[model samples]
Target: MNEPDVAVDEALPAPRPMPHGLDPDGLTVGVEEEFLLVNARTRRVASQAPSVLAAAADRLPGLRPELTRFQLEVATATCRTAEELHRQLRTARGTLTAVAREHGLRLAATGSPVLGRVTPPPLTDHPRYEALIGQYGALADALSLCGYHVHVGMPGREYAVQVSNHLRPWLPVLLAISANSPFWDERDTGHASWRYLLWSRWPSAGPPPRFASPAHYDSAVRTLLHTGAALDAGMTYWDIRLSAVHPTIEVRVCDAPATVDEALLLALLTRALVATALAATEPAPAIPQHALRAALWRSARDGLEGMGVDAVEREVLPMRELTQRLVEHARPALEATGDLAVCTELLDAVLRRNSGAARQRRAFCRRQRLTDVVDLLTAQTAGATALT
Candidate 1:
């Protein structure tokens, strides 16, 4: 297969000269998390997003509709610290869960709707989403998978693009740490993040190729748009891309986390990853396209449970060992941002409990019930229980 389009469009004004390390003001971070809304009684996905949004609008200021009616997104304002991001996510999840309950719905941060109902919920009434449904046909319906996008500030577009080139090899590592979607269509998909596998079917979705410069990245994006492969620059849904709406490198590799702490851990790791890339003298060389895709597939398939491709070494290693190396690689950045301890603790907890995929599977195994799995996810999403 040909290489996936790794184009990232410039979202900022003309670049201004700036020194590279951590930005003097510090790298800001923001998180966008999407959730599935399911009926409280039937546990079926509920197409009640509009109604839920209206009811919760006052309580949740930045709530937004997703491609499907069964999904809702909550994004936090930019923050300078992980603590702030954690607090905001907690509040957003709590408020949304409460409002959803009022409407007899449950919010699940897990990857897919738990039960096996085949008919997809209706698409949201929006021109963009409508255009997608028309263009992609059945592929559009699979867009119901939820994801977590973490935006980390970079000094400028050139810097962001440079970081992106350097960031590619590490993308699989990030994906493994955040994999939480194991079940889809009410059955274990066998892959840790079936959401990623489903989403990758998009023409523009997957790890981007290494770029020579920001101009090269922008040109590639324009080329893709001209071909109608993507509706717009925003459709360049590479695992990591320059944000079309913000001055940040958006990491879109992970499933929407099941809890606030998981979300925060992802944010911390993302910022650290970007910072480490910026400070580096050289980024990893472009892996062969085949290798890049294989690494990503392994991450989505096994998550922490299987072997992972060590893009840096170009060899596969135990996923647990690979993740530990990722933390060490980003340690300098974590320390600079005062997040080292918290990040370490959170990563440890995730490994201990296994990724969200493991926990969801365990719940089903123990009770032999999908509702029990849904219950576990809802409780975690609302922060009513710890990650374990």
Candidate 2:
């Protein structure tokens, strides 16, 4: 994408006032998880989102359409506690699974299609989506990606922007843990999270710049908009960003995890990370852009089973070490929120399995059939069984 020569002083809305006496540990958190609707018999993505969504119309506001007709998204209501968030996610997943079954489909929470042909799925019926296809042809066609997005409440946009800086170094680690897209189009992609690589094709996607201030963030966004790299703030697609429609810092680093327990782990750790950032007295780490990108690639390529780069130190280390560092860094906040024990248990479970990617690979290796992978995803998505 070409960078447009635009004035940096574009008028933008003033930042809102920071809330007084805000408690970081008590901040509300929510998640929006995307899933692929799969044909139960064929084990292929089914473009029945329109009919399925209509069947689930009563679950509106919580359940919504995605960029592709094969994709559906479910969002949790703002939750004050980790357990409450877990309940919401479980209920949402269960309800959606039932609704999809009613339409002769199954909800697969894997990040990408496991057993389908690599054909362009139908675009959702919306003018904005049509415009996207018109603007970015092939990129729009390969939009069958699913993600687990976490929103951590912030005091204001300015604060959220600052929190994003603190988030950059840890983003890769989170991606590694939630890496679930091992197979695509009936073949292993070799990369754990193929979704991340596919998503990076977007002009405005991936790690965001480290802004010095809220104005700097706005200036950078204005440049993307002016250059048409991004259609609007909502399209910025940064791994971390100030939510365009909510008073929260949204983290988009993770692919949709295989199970609700995995999703809860991401949410709890993310909230704790945000709380840690809020309490920090030191400035955000000054990791270089190249180092950050390298770290992300390493995470996506290896998931939690290989070496990872410590962006801050610019040194490669075992991914397990990086994950430990992440938990340690966020320990105080985790304890403050009374989620440390549950987070520890979830983290232990994930590590034992290696990652969602590893679990999928294990399933595939068992029968050497992608249908097994699809079955695993379908079963897990419906809360019928776990990867173990």
Candidate 3:
């Protein structure tokens, strides 16, 4: 059944103000995690988000509808510490798990659906969404992808744009760590993140251009709007961009990870990256756009298990080496935020078990059934099982 667009309640908590005299090192961070609603029995995408969200509204007031009825999203209140974000993510995911279960559905954090239906999934009943479908046609029709976004507070929009330049080279490394969509349409797509390929169909959805200044960024967005490549500023779907509604830089590069801890790891790493970028005295390297694109493709194809392109060096290297370099790049910031130890532990765990995509493929190989992969994702989302 098609679901009506559900409005988010104002009762949701606002971004928390930084405590008095808190070290600016502790930049506020928030995350928005998108999830797919799956039928518990059939293990297929279920267009029941409106009812699931309605049932969860009073208890889990932060829940909101997404572009498609088969998906739901929740944003964390602004947080200063990883511990605080961890608690909030756990509470939200737990509540959503119970709510979805009661409504005969399961919340799966995988990037794309593992099963297929005869018809396209229904879009939420919103006029803007209808217009998007009218404008983009098939590109908008294949919009059932879920992503994990991290928003780090910035002093100003111009500074945020500058920081994004520093962030460009590391984007592929981050995507490799969080690549979670290996299966789609009941088959292994052989790519760690099929969602990335699917999402790239949008003309405005890949890596953002390196802007010389805030004016350059604005002019580029204006071009997208004038050319009808994007319906609005919100549609400037760069991998990272200044948030339209928040005083933060938003990184929208990863698939929705399978576990809350994975989400926390991404959030902490992103905050550290932003903080590191802000403190740097030297200019960021001007890596060629073609090199960066090649790096992104490698990250999406091989995830953490294979070679990755070093955009800075213009050479291919082991993903493990690139992953370590990313951690080292943000080491000072991680230490300042007291998250270095935790980040190290999480990185070790992910490497030991493999990326989410690798784990999902392993599950399918064990039983040769897509349903087993769905079960794994459902369990991981609910924190019912270790992401082993």
Candidate 4:
């Protein structure tokens, strides 16, 4: 009889190599979609994240985190190409819907839906969430509002910050493109993108100065940390900025886009923005911060409705004219990604619809009820193209 001893410790598998790309070996597209859970029957915000995730835990393809008890987030897997990213998003959304249905919960993608009153929910017991709420208080909870943050990995932090800075001029344009939030706190705010205005209330919100370099951006972040303007880089919540953790420029300005098509339009524009900005080797334009802030307000107030933004000329113009000029400016980038058709289709869609904000407003107006808004928002779950 021979007794062979088995080792107590097993050999761990080697880490997989990151994907190769022109941007970086690790360069890829990632998305963070914050969603609000609603009662399928009542259409009110549901505190069912834990229950739903528990039931669907086996199916989620990528990281799924609950921001609040009622809010769930699903991230797209890192992919070298947009097509792959789209696939990942589709898979994730499908999984969420399947899981939510298991728990009789409906998930909705919206910056702010009109039917519910949002007060800070107890921070989920997770340490990061608890600490985040502890440090930031109700602000973290107030962000119960949903948003989709698209991150495009860059070659270096320096390049990312440069892109971030270069992006400041176009930040409002980005915001305008995805301005889908029309209601706040169960009431019509008479604005297309009330979420944008709501988000800017935080101390560290909005576009920051164009950094001289990554080092310069770091210095400013460090200074803010020391002075207590922000507890950490994450709290800055800039419309666009270099992520302290990920080597990517995080475009935080866009509202919750209605569908995958809308998300990709914004994503391509984001990547093209970085490409165009890098190619120009230009310093951040010398635009007034106040003017930028005001422009954002105008976009939110009248997403392609009121006068258009004239950043350089500093005058009001037609929204359609501004939209066309913005498209033309982004033409080269669109062509490079082969997303020109998609972008045009989506752009025309945005122009025709009243923005997500406008659509929400109209939906609420027709029904003349907040509860109806909830039903409409619930249909926005999964993907915009998906038949509810």
Candidate 5:
């Protein structure tokens, strides 16, 4: 697939006609992935991120820490297309993996793992994190979890807010696609994304209400902060939200996908969804907040193995059919971005091979050891497939 035209400020030598009805100049892409560090021998959560970062300080530029010492995050610079995102994903994962291996640690890109056991490592020594530890206590401590967030550029705040509202119903399908966390605390949680469950423990986490405008969105965020439901604007942890810092709509529904392919797939589809929402002339459907919550739970519980909520119908559908519906919904934007063929191929690949959760379970069944799942995730995180 051709990379999306990323040149924003300067004119191209020759402008190509935008295909498939996408606003070629309007949409850009960025991704943030959080990964867990585990001891190489024991496959347990390792508080060695600091050491790894210190060792590779000059090598990995975007590498940084998460809430816990066991987690590390890498953010990709804004890019123009799926191809660029794929390349960035490979470089980030490969560099991080090499650095961790030097420290006798392994990097696994899943939502949550059994390695943390009863408790995760201590919080990072940041003052803001210190405040979270003091306020949220165990809720903050047990957060050895990680997620992949996709950001799609919006024209402005209004479009970002509207796109966020329109994209709500589709969030579950995306969640099911990237559901990589099935085991937690050394036991199978039976849910595809145990990370989502762990994350929702925070008062400010979950789906955001439909906003009339960007001002309404700002007001809602202020309410959460004033009531102490959130520590700050950054903690608004909606499954999807207009980003607080960047000028993009960010989707936080996915687990830290187990492979670079799956991570790029998530970013491609997310950009398509945002583009589709922006092109829509009609208002987004009004599914009740309760129904939306139920839909999210259904996606987390069944993933691609069973039925998922049909957000519009407020009922259930086989995940296979639900995924196809999503593809069809985003077809135009995918084609416009030159990602339709790759996205369709990847979607078929995911269905045929099964979700990361299913694959992890299969690995565990083969060995009857939870650490096998950890090993599998560790290996898969390192550029599972080469990008053409």
Candidate 6:
């Protein structure tokens, strides 16, 4: 049953004691990818999630969660190194692709397929999602709102929070680089990532300020609960924030990356970014929110082709230039982890031509029909298609 649109709130899951200090050597990376369900025959979305889940239970390992009947979330095992991260992502994709094929379905990677509508069957009966529907009601089940979540294990809660504080200012740059959602409900939304707008609506979403300390961060979360500002500490979906459960800071700005390389580039960059911030003597100075948001808008509207305003120096920088600047800026930190080469090689490709969304648009224009676009999107998500 759907909760009324009227005001009603429910208590959140209980908070537990925080974890220990950050571990520099104990590197672990985890990824949770969300996808929309689509019919194999039509390529249009079908709420065929429950049937697919049941049929493919043996295929999926322990980490898959059904967000809705048509929506699925698959997580990678905690990777101890970059190679492990790559392997886990491939395994998750392979298993999910095989299962989807068995059920005559395809998983889509785009944040919101141009043709998606929020209507879809609710597959899971879990209280967590039920509580979600009951609380937010219709607003919670937006089917097109797809995303990719990457968790970088932090040294500890305090360092995670500290990194999160510094990371918030740069979250928009990540979003700009990763903008891949160009259409909604099968029509052009005129924004590279309409999904970003949807995500920003949630109370806990968007960039957060620098927390004073890990202890201060915890106290603030507690205060949010006591004041009714948040349903729980988990709701603190700050664009960049320390995970209350995991010993990591979670970055939530990116739309689900279309290509595997895009995903890996983001993952590597995030690790380098965090290390850079943590080692710095003073907090990274904040970027002007207005300028950052405007750059984000340009990035979403035009992807890498759009020029962004430099909030720091107050000038216009070409998207390609900004991207280069980011790589150069993070060279020292990436070098620390020896992932600088990975980042440089990936950026070379992204800067040259078009992004995933751009290529998808080109394909759609080639066939001049929505069906063709669906075929393209389905292939990318299913891993049967390739741009590599």
Best by TM-score: 2
Candidate closer to the true structure by lDDT (higher is better), 2 or 6: 2
TM-score for all models, in order of appearance? 0.93, 0.94, 0.93, 0.87, 0.92, 0.86
Clashes per prediction? 0, 0, 0, 2, 2, 8
Model 3 lDDT on a 0 to 1 scale: 0.87
**Please, what are the lDDT tens digits per residue for candidate 6 over residues 77-101?**
7776667777777777677777787
In candidate 3, position 37 carries an lDDT of: 90
| Backbone clashes in model 1, listed as residue pairs | none
Q: State in Å the error of residue 210, model 4.
A: 1.6
lDDT (Cα, 0-100) at 122 in candidate 4: 41
The C-alpha lDDT values of all candidates are 0.84, 0.87, 0.87, 0.70, 0.83, 0.68
Candidate 2 residue lDDT tens string, 1-388: 3333223233323333346788878989999999999998898889999998888879646888898999998888999998799999988888889888998899999888887754666888899888887788888756899999999988877788668878999999999999999888778999999999999999999998877666778888888899999887889899998887988889999999999999999999999998888777666777777789999999999999988999998889999999999999999999999999999998998888778899899988998988888888899888888657
What is the TM-score of candidate 3? Answer: 0.93
Q: After superposition, how far is residue 40 of candidate 3 from its true place, in Å?
A: 0.9
Model 5 lDDT-worst window of ten: 8-17
Clashing pairs in 5: 4-81, 114-186
Candidate 5 residue 56 Cα shift, in angstroms, is 2.5
Expressed as tens digits, the lDDT of each residue in 1-388 for candidate 5 is 2223222233222212234554643589999999999999999988877898787778867778888888899999999977888999999999999989988998888888666663734777899988887788778755788999998876678777778778989988998999888998788999998888788878888877766667778888887898988899999999888888888889998998888888989999888888887777677776667788888899899998889999878778998899999989989888887899999888788898999999989889997998888888888987653221
Which 10 residues in a row give candidate 2 its minimum summed lDDT? 4-13
Cα deviation of 329 in candidate 6 (Å)? Answer: 1.9
Model 1 ranges off by over 4 Å:
1-25, 116-118
Q: What is candidate 3's lDDT per residue for 260-343, written digit by digit as tens?
A: 989999999999998887776666677666678788999999998888988787779999899899999999999998999999
Better of 1 and 5 by TM-score: 1
Candidate 3 regions exceeding 4 Å error are 1-24
Candidate 6 RMSD to the real structure: 7.0
For residue 232, model 5's alpha carbon misses the true position, in angstroms, by 0.9
Per-residue lDDT over 1-388 for candidate 1, one digit per residue giving the tens place of the 0 to 100 score: 2333442332223223448444732789898999999899888888899999999888887899888888899899999987788889989999999999999999999777787463554889989988887787888868888999989887788888877777788888888887888887878888998989998999889988677567778877877798888999989989889998888899898888888888899888888888777776744465766788899999999998789999756798999999888899898888877899999999899988888888988999997999899889999988889987
